[model samples]
Target: MATRAEPIRQLRLRTPTDLEAEAVRNVAGALNALLADTFALYLKTKNFHWHVSGPHFRDYHLMLDEQATQIFAMTDELAERVRKIGAPTLRSIGQIAGMQRVLDNNADYVDPDDMLAELRDDNKDFVQRMREARDLCDDSRDAATASLLETFIDQSERRVWFLYETSRRGDGTGH
Candidate 1:
């Protein structure tokens, strides 16, 4: 019943019949984490965009807007990669919760400092997930996806450092 017409049909992509099962599963697992992390982090970025208020409000607001755009783009790229591997792309919040290794913040009111803390943690989680993805990709001899994961992990590390630095400032303890 499989056909090439379906938008999500991935068998057409032609993966090796003898592909490393464990490595593929690990890569898929890591991508699922990335999927959920990106979605949840997208929500957090939107929250901070709406709620952030401090002397650095304008700066953070602009930065968050740009970061959110990048995150959303990453989400799409990751989902497509899942489809390319003949796996189902994550489609629901429940699935996201099942796969994500990171915890969401429960603060009723997020001060700017807390917002930065939240984003830093989120980015760190994403970076770790990407690192795992790269490892799996390497084991599977998937240089293309490994290269993509390299970009994602690099961006995540940079974002984490930027947010952490913002949170740890002294004179500009603006968070």
Candidate 2:
């Protein structure tokens, strides 16, 4: 005899009494995209941390490790925020890859300076995306999400600053 298959559970969002359902949906979508980008950036930073080699290897490696940790930390918070608003969050790396705008580095060999520059540019681009997400939250009047994004924007700006300073030449002449 053939066994009967279990019925799939259909999840439904219990909309919060305080927030508008439409706004919550919009904010959750923006947060999911932001979450994807954060994951991509986190992985890239960790990659650089592991492969970094140069006279300043210690400094660059340590910095990337710390930055990767920070980026990773943000991912959970972002996913939780989406769930809190009664929306589904990212489930797999493929979902993230589809949503992410950040470029990946697959080269077997990358110059130390080039790695730093590439990461620096990527972080800068991330900040821009964060700003766009924040704006969406603001427009939706999702104060909680918007406030969280402010902190993220500040952290990203700091990362960009650190990367920029580290990549600069010590000599008076800038590269």
What TM-score would each prediction reach against the true structure?
0.81, 0.89
Model 1 segments beyond 4 Å from truth?
1-18, 172-175
Which tens-of-lDDT digit does each residue in 51-160 have in candidate 1? Answer: 88988899899888888888888998998876666556787999988876667666677888888887888788778778877888888887777998999888888888
Task: Give Cα-based local distance difference scores for all models.
Answer: 0.79, 0.86
Q: Tens digit of lDDT per residue, candidate 2, span 34-56?
A: 99999999998988899998788
Candidate 2 structure lDDT:
0.86
Q: Candidate 2: list runs displaced more than 4 Å.
A: 1-17, 172-175
Best by TM-score: 2
Q: After superposition, how far is residue 89 of candidate 2 from its true place, in Å?
A: 0.2
Model 2 backbone overlap count:
0
Q: Candidate 1 versus the native: TM-score?
A: 0.81
